[model samples]
Target: MDTTKIEKNFKKLTSSNKIFESVLMIGNASGDFNFTREYKRDIDTPMLMASTTKLLTTTCIYALVQEGKLNLKDELSNYLSKEEISGLHVFKGKEYTFELTIEHLLSQTSGLPDFYLTGTKPVFSKVKDRDFSYSFEEELEWIKHMKARFIPGTKRKAYYSDVNFDLLGKIIEAANASTLQEAYEKYIFSPLNLKHTYLANTESDFIPHTYYKDQRLYRPLFIRSCYASGGGVTTARELMIFIKAFWKGELFDKTFFSKQAQSNPLQMSFYPIHYMGGYMKITASYPFGKKYTLVGHSGSTGAFAFYCLEKDLFIVGDVSQIASPSTGVRLAMRTVLAAE
Candidate 1:
């Protein structure tokens, strides 16, 4: 595919006003595209991937399932203590916490309140250093304080909860008998040959800094404890490789992938686009009224990766701006449309 128009549109995207850096990359099925341009940072720079880390965690879980080590229908009670999950899903005077399964967590159908945004609206603020740190135990205590939004497996309502993946992180460690970082390295990073992906357990100057409303955020403490959920940091190229593997079902069985694709009823998100099982399905009308649909995922930290099946196109990159996270999705759409 000719990328001249994509490159031109990327130029305009980076030219727009922003407080932090941006990156963009586009490729095809053979994975031949490695071209990159930076606005204020280098192509090698690594940045926080935010919720895109969910894709990694989910992929790892599926790998375990394919190995016959675990099943999606398995209950959380089998892996976690009843006391640990008590009052987690109190719906209509009934506590359905232990009934939650790995499937509910992966599809965001657990009805569990988000540990991060339970009561507060998103705010763009300034930061200087690593702000705070909390253990997974502490996060669970917080979740217990919050009320459940609905019963588990409601089918009509899916609430995106960090706690869901945080629990999954624990499950991964339990199943692998190792830390989430180690498990990822063994099953994913190493096998995929991803050179620049890691969980940011501590503040590092090497990781690209992010800004919200002109004020920098000290990498949150939760980033470390939430490694399987949203603590990962990576580059555009590495993310694209993962996306390609995801769509191609390289690490998991095709039947498992088919199950996930068919289980979008809970409505985890729209983002002005549709998403399921950590993947977004892009659909929109371009100039002259042509429409398209692509599948991939985006991070709230202005990161995006997607594959346009019809065009055999794969695009991945980030704006590295938290204040306008939606900017990354818009840029991806613009780039995809420009290719037409």
Candidate 2:
């Protein structure tokens, strides 16, 4: 592949957006055909992954399932106490808390409200003004007062909620008897030899500041509080290795990919994107309006890790801008089209 066009396009993109310190990497499944481009940041620079961290949580959940410690059909009540989950999903005055299952959360069909974006007191808007930490218990408390969108397992229903993955993180701890960070280290980082990928757990953990337009935001407490839903930091190189392994079945059964691929359209805010088993999917239309599927996830902080099934290529990178979450996806699409 002649990379002249790829390099030129990347340079143009960075030049036009001066606040964009970015990295773009492309590789094949077999570890060959590698290409990387950086603007003001190298492949080794760690960046906040935001919601792209959900893919890592999904990997650990699959590992537990393979080990017979978890099952998709298992009820949420199995792992969480009644007091913790009660009143969580009360739609139309019908309590459907116990009706939720591991599959529901993984597929984002639990009808649960998003604590970060929803509710009268949404944390998303407040985070821009101030930095603070909130525990899982606090997040759950916020969800309890919010209204659920639909009933669990409703046909053709899917809502993006950080609370879903946060709950899964708790279930993983209950089933595996280990911390979510430790589980990630064992099932993903250690196995893939990813030295720079980790869940941001403390102030000691270094987290790269992200941009919301021209302003730089460094909310370490907010990032740490996101936990499994979003709190993750990694370099472009390490993220490329992990995403390739995920699609190549190096960590868990690749067969699960088929089941997870039965995606449902998310809310209107996430138009043209679908929710799969803990990941995002977009059928991107390149030049001449030709469409192809890109499987994986993008984060609110302009981070992305995706695999183009039609092209048989893995694309991973970060745009380092919070105001434009879709920038990474557009960049990945352009990179794939440019490589051809």
Candidate 3:
């Protein structure tokens, strides 16, 4: 563990822009190189995990699978009524709504257009003010108004849809007869004793502000509607704990974990960030001819939690810049290289 080198890399990343506050935590199974450092934000402040929330959502889903409560291959209609998810994934000239499966949603293969970015005009464009937020129910209504990207299960095709996980959130709730937040606490946070990690159910929660361009803003209250998809909040220390347990099979068996990562990946809207099932993977070669593969997930608000399988290392933190989503990955790479 090279604290000097890791801090050096963190400093470089924060210097890039005013919006780029950060907290970085890196550790290995041996507890070497384990430290938490923050820039502009306190080390204990809880920040939005953004899309990294999916990692938690998927973990809960898989736990249910392990307990025989759910099956990945189960159809979406099995749990959701047609009215609840109605018109959400209509294709060229046909409706494949019920045909969509849990596996499709988990792997982003459902062909559901991303309600945020995939529309002919993105949903964000509808936001007259950047301060606006939306509820998950409202997001589903908006999704019902959009068209599907393709027929479900088309070979070599996947679209990153927040809708998929939103529906999965609903499924988790339906399956458990409880709220998504409670499900998370029972299945993930509680067992792991993660006192700080939780779904941000409202904008008034004590979450740190994230940077979007030049604006400093707290995530919208409505964004909490997407809690199952990207509405998690956690400190750097807890984020590392979750990611390490996630990849090391602490939440479930290793065979199920492997199944979660075995799907074909789709490039996220960021560099070096790829998605398979509910997790993200980063594959890169450091300058010294060393290649690293790290798996977990990152948030668009520059939050990241990933573990390097080859090195048994965990990197968790945020660059806190919406525009600098790649900063976390860059820091992870540099940190790994420096540790060597």
Candidate 4:
């Protein structure tokens, strides 16, 4: 690997692009590949990881299953005896309690309302100390009150609901008798020796800060209180490390990983998340054949990333811009296949 060319390419990437701030590293998870690594300033400075947090939730669920503390098929109502889980008439409706389950949350099949439904924006914008928060119990409570548009588990649409991961967070907590943050920290972060990666619920001051107005919307490092399971905060190094480790069979049973890799036909896949789980699997397209089957995930909003597993050990430069990193992923493929 030519350091000069790599550095030149990276410099060109960040210099020309509007990278708000990012940190990234790419290499082999199991000692097979190590390419250019750039973990520069403000990179991985503990920004919000957004939907990539779902992968984290998935890991926690699998761990509980592996430990026999939770079952995918078990009804979630069995654990919570509160008013929300009861089949009684609570929501001015019938016994509307048959639509909830653990797998429903895991597969996004709970028929739960999408997060975008509640738009209090005009009022929310006027408030100063309005921290963006969504409670798990309240969401489930809403589900209890709300009627399903369709039966659960019939369709596999990629409905973006924070409630899905929030429920999984609850399930993880119930299975371990600990907070989702504790379970994630103890099982995943700590084991990986990942300093920059903190569970959403874990409070930390060093996670960096971002601003919206004078109010400072949410502390970039301290936001897990509400959106922990779905949109966790993390850095480039941490994200890359976790992705590589999980993909390389360093963390769990190969069989389970394979199971996770199974594609969801009902949902259209996107860059870096071609298959699902920790990544997307791409086989080929009219543009790039075979090499296009790159596996990875893109989120942690305003940030784009890719990691090549089968073709070349690679990680791309991070950009905290509005555009998704798919464009860059396509360009980088040309470099990875240069017959090094």
Q: Output the number of the lDDT-best candidate.
A: 2
Clashes of each: 1, 0, 0, 15
Model 3 stretches astray by more than 4 angstroms: 3-5, 125-128, 202-204, 260-263, 286-288
lDDT of 3 by residue, 266-318 (tens): 63565555567777667878567878887787766778788888877788888
Decreasing TM-score order of the candidates: 2, 3, 1, 4
lDDT of 4 by residue, 220-323 (tens): 32255445444466777677777766655566554665665355432332423333443345443445534545555444333334555565464634444323
The Cα RMSD in angstroms, rounded to one decimal, for candidate 1 relative to the true structure is: 2.8
Cα error, residue 313 of model 1, in Å, equals 1.4
Error of 3 at 159 (Å): 1.5
- What's the lDDT of the predicted structure labeled candidate 2? 0.90
Clashes of 4: 15
Which structure among the candidates has the greatest TM-score? 2
Better of 1 and 2 by TM-score: 2
lDDT ranking from best candidate downward: 2, 3, 1, 4
User: What's the lDDT for residue 67 in model 4?
Assistant: 76
Per-residue CA lDDT of model 1 for 1-340, tens digit only, reads 5668878877887777774688887777676655566787765678788878888888888888877777889999888888887877877788888899988887788888875643442212212323556788877777777778888877556776778888888888888888888888877898899989987776652344677656676565545655677788888778878778777868776466465545343333444555466555667566677777767777768888888777778778888777677788888788778785
TM-score of each: 0.89, 0.96, 0.91, 0.72
Ten contiguous residues minimizing lDDT sum, candidate 2: 11-20
lDDT of 4 at 233: 65
